[model samples]
Every structure is written in C-alpha cells, then in structure tokens.
Target: MPPNINNTTQLAQNSDKMAAPISPEETLARFEELSVLEAEFEDAELELIRKSTALNEPLWKKRAEIVAKIPHFWTLVLEQIPVELETFIQPTDFQLFANSLQTIEVSRFEIDDPKGSPRSFSIKFGFDDNEYFFNKELEKKFWYRKSKDWAGLVSEPVKIVWKKGKDLTEGLTDAAYDLAQAKKTLAKTSGGKSKAKAEASLPEYKTLASKIEDDTEGAPSFFTWFGFVSSYRWISAEESEEADKEEKTRLEKLKRGEKLDDDEDEDDEDDDADYQETEVFPQGDECATLLAEDVWPSALRYFKQAHEADDEELSEIDVDDMDQDDSDGEIDIRGLVSKGRTSSTSPPSKKQRKA
Candidate 1:
C-alpha cells in the first residue's frame, strides 16, 4: 500500500502463503493423533462387547436348550448361512449337517480374561454318533491376538480323528494336523530357531502341500475348518503380548516426536517380508466370524427365514400349476376347494343373491 501496490496482487500473495506445503513433522503429528483416536475407539468397542456378552450368557443357554429339542434346527439354520460361507460347504458337508449335526453353539470363551479379548470365541458342534469323526463334540477356538506384522484370530488345528474312510475333507485335515505337529516338534528341537529354515525337510509339510495342490474338487469341505490356523503366522499368547507391548511403546515414542532408528525400521520391514506360506483354509476366519456374530446371535431369525423360503417355493409351484391348468382350459375344482376358494360353478352366496 505504501508503494501503491494493487489490492488484487496483495490478495493473490496472501493466498499463495496460505497454500504453503505442510512440514513432514506437522503431518506426522496429525497422523499420530488420528492413530491414537482409532485405538481409543477400538478399546471402546471391546468394552461394549464384554458387557453385552455377560448380559447374553443366560439367554444363550436357554436358547440352546430350546433349539436342541427341535430336530434338525441347526441344520436348517446353517442352510441359511451367508453365500460366502455357503460356498465352502460341499454336498458331503451338507449331508453330515442334515444327518448327524445335533447342536451348534458359539461362545466368547475368553471374555473374562484380563489379557484376552472379548472378540475371541469358540464354535462348538455336537453330533449324534456321527459316522464321520470320533469326537461327539468338536469345538474350534479362535484367539484375538496381535503380532508385529499381523493381528486377529489365531487357532491351532483341532484334530478331527476321522473314522476310517469317512473323512469329508478327503485327508486335508489329517495332513494339516500332521504338518502342525511336525512344525511344533521341529521348533522344540531347533532351540527357537525359525521353522522355515528346515521346513522343506519335513515330510508332513510336503505331504500337505501336495494334497492341497492335487485337490480336484470344486470347493473344499466345510469340515476342513477344524484344521484352520491363523491367516498369518501363528503367534503364541506370550509372543503376542510382547509384540503388543513393543508396538505400544513405539507408538508412544512416535506421538512424542521421537524418531525411530533406521536399523529398527529396516528390521521391521524384513520381518514383514517373511510371509507365511501354508494356508489350509484361507477363509476360515471369515467363516468363524460369521458363525459367531451372525448365525449364533440370530439363529431364530435364520430358522424363520429358512421356513419362509420353503413356503415361498411351495407357493410358486402352486401358482405355476394354476397357470398350466388355465392354459389347458381345465380347472381343478378340488384344488380350489382344498385352498378354501369357491369355484365358479358353486351357487351364489346369500348376500350376492340378495344384491
């Protein structure tokens, strides 16, 4: 203004100053604040789950007793599972569910544990002397855990102990169990060294890999879920706790504007690069979550849905038959009478006659 500068020029200069790039430090600080907020939200969610689980315990038990008396109740409920889970259930699996599946229950097994997560749960399946497996009750548990590079539900393969020639999974479960045992043995013998260094030497591992590759079936059996492991590498509870603590410490330092060492960052990258190679049931976690969250809590609704579907099918068939009869210029008077419909040939009602 002192030098007769144009007002438009001054305004444009001010806009340019306002549009200056954010410093990396400021950007990182903002990101850290958001990360902390996300963590708080997660903690809140877990607290709510814990509270709800307690409130629903007695109700779940009562519901289980009621459904147990209804023949094929679990089977019908399973049939109404989401398509993502339905795709994994082969024809053989359905047969097992229909014939022998007696009861299905989902429980938050670790809800009370201080270190454990309310999100951790188990799927328990009861069978009535099934021809498939030796276990009368099969329960698969999933632990909500965190590792350095990954986190979520992790489970050890539940051994099915199949009857001779009755394994619905076609030996996949057996092979998976063997491989897991072999790895455990190897880990103990090798004094905590990485199992991958000598995994190729293990016969159990090779056999399972070959079996998985040679499978010609369109989809693996739902029973194979008993052999499911973590989506990433399996981490023990102790290891998970250690990793969680370390992560919390790292985040604290990040929030305080402390720079992470270059070497530590490089090491973390290397750890992430070591991906787990074997995956018996990749969608097992999703299936387990669906069973726990949707199928378990809403069993009655799903059962009703199944019945509604059957009724709709029958109604459609009746409509189609009626159309065919009309097209043929014939009417089934008995059919109309059975459905409580008056035939055209019937005499007029008293009200109609009066009109």
Candidate 2:
C-alpha cells in the first residue's frame, strides 16, 4: 500500500512537469500583435508629418508672394521715409525678399479710382516717363465661370488690399497698408512716442503710396497703382537725442581727416532686400506644431515598439505565472496577461539580464 501511494505521488509530479509553459506559436502571435499596434502608430505619425509639411507650404507660398511686392513698396516710400534709410545693402537682403518675388510670377498693377485721390487706398498710372499710384481695395477678378461648371466656381476671387485696412487715414495709411500689419508690430516693439508718430503719419504715407508706381506696367488698378509703400517712420526727437553721441563721434572723425561722401552722390543700391513686412507668410505656432511638435515623437515611438516586438522581448511570462498561487486566493487572469498580450515565453532586455 505504501509503494502504490508513492508511485501515485511520483506520477502526479511527472504530470505537472510535462505541462507546457507557452507555445512558440503563441509567443510569436504576441509579438505580431505588438507589431500591429506599432504599425498603426507609425502610419498615424507619417500621415501627421505629411499634413504638417502641407501646412507650412501655404505659409511659405504666401510669404514669398507678398515679399515679391516689397520693391514696389520701397520705391514708393524711399524719399518719403522720415529718417533716411541705411545705405548698406548686402545681397542677403535681396535674397530675403525682392529676388524671391520674381519666382512666384503673380500679375500685379495699380490704378486710380474716386474712392480717394492717389492716397489712402487709390490707384494711379504713368503715360510717358512718369510713375503713378493709388489706394483701392484690389480684388483679383477670377473668371471661374469659364470652367464650365456652376458648382465649381469659387464664390470670391482672390483679393487682397492691406492688412485690416479700416483703421487708417488717407495720406499716412498707405504706408501701413502697403506694409500689411508690420508697422503695428514694429511700433509695438518700438513702443511709446515712436508708435504714436507712426500712427499719426499713416494717413500721409498712404497718400504718398497712392502717388508713385512702377511705370513699366499697363494701366494699374487703384490697389495696384501704389507699387509698394514702406511703413518705416521718422526717428523721433528722443531718438535723435540718443544718437547725439554717435553723431558727435562721426563729426570728430570728419574734423580729424575723414572725407564724408554724401548719399546723394552715391548711386543708391535701392537696398530693398532685408525689408520684411507682415505680407510674408510667417511660421509661428501653427508651423511649429505640425513640423516638430506633432509627428516625430509618434513616429519614433512606433518605430521603437516594432523593433522590440521583432526581438521577441515580451516572451518571458508563461501560463503558470498566471496560475501561480495568489496571496488572496483569487484567480488573477489579468496577472496572466500583460497589457492584453499574453503569449511570450522568452524575455525582454530588462528581464534577460536578470535571467
């Protein structure tokens, strides 16, 4: 009787030993599941990246288009700017704006209208050797009806005047208008009296723009008549006071033996290069979110997950681990499964080191 009992005990032990830990196929299946999750994440990240790139393109295009118009604006404002422009113009400035405009190839012109004289928002033209300008809401008249589908037609043609054109005067407004919203931004950065002065001169600047234009083009629109107008304003009395030291030093240099060549003598390099107004499509919050903030992390996460899954890192736990006696005597199916993945019999890098 004792021998039979021992034999029965031994048989039970053998049976327990024979029970499988986990099948190789099940482990592979878990890895495949991880791969799938990673794949989905990867696809989402890639799509998001594409969307981000698309988002920035429009802004770049807008900026490029608007920058193209800078020369026309600078020409209009050259003589009128209260402070003389800095004479130095390196190639970098041209590359930044005017050069870029020639690439977009948009048709542009200005004309005169009754809404106002060649000021504020009207247009003008030149006949023999004279230039013209104007101040008018320039609207691109699109002939969408030519496309042959009534539903296909866009409701409004592409039209642009100045930025928020309402809060401006006739003579000074064109400077602000031609620059789009840059003068406001510049004034804000400059602050106090300078800002006030810029605000004051907006009407006169606008009037100035309405007068001059690039005469090569045909009859211009009230909007196009103003080739372009710079929003740069005078150095205030305070600014002149502040520059006294620098001017004194320059004068001393001249007295000592420096020859001062006047600007009028130099063939001015219409240095319209570095001037950037609000017209340029600028990347700030929206662009940063799409390009750097949103897509790459998601992509990297998915890529790393796929790599770990491919290496069979989740194969350490088996069914017996799930079946192990619990402290509370409760069956914990969740203990057997890990994040809904349960088939691995091998180990991850962290677990392998311990093994």
The regions of model 1 sitting more than 4 angstroms off are: 1-21, 254-259, 262-276, 314-355
Best by lDDT: 1
Best by TM-score: 1
Model 2, position 71, has a per-residue lDDT of: 36
lDDT of 1 at 281: 88
Residue-level lDDT of model 2, residues 16-118, one tens digit each, is: 5666455554454444444345545644864664565456547645654664554332222111212111111112222222211122211111112221111
TM-score of each: 0.78, 0.17
Distance from true location, Cα of 63 in model 1, Å: 0.6
Worst 10 residues of 2 by lDDT: 143-152
Give me the overall lDDT of model 1.
0.71
Model 2 spans > 4 angstroms off: 1-182, 189-228, 231-245, 256-273, 276-355
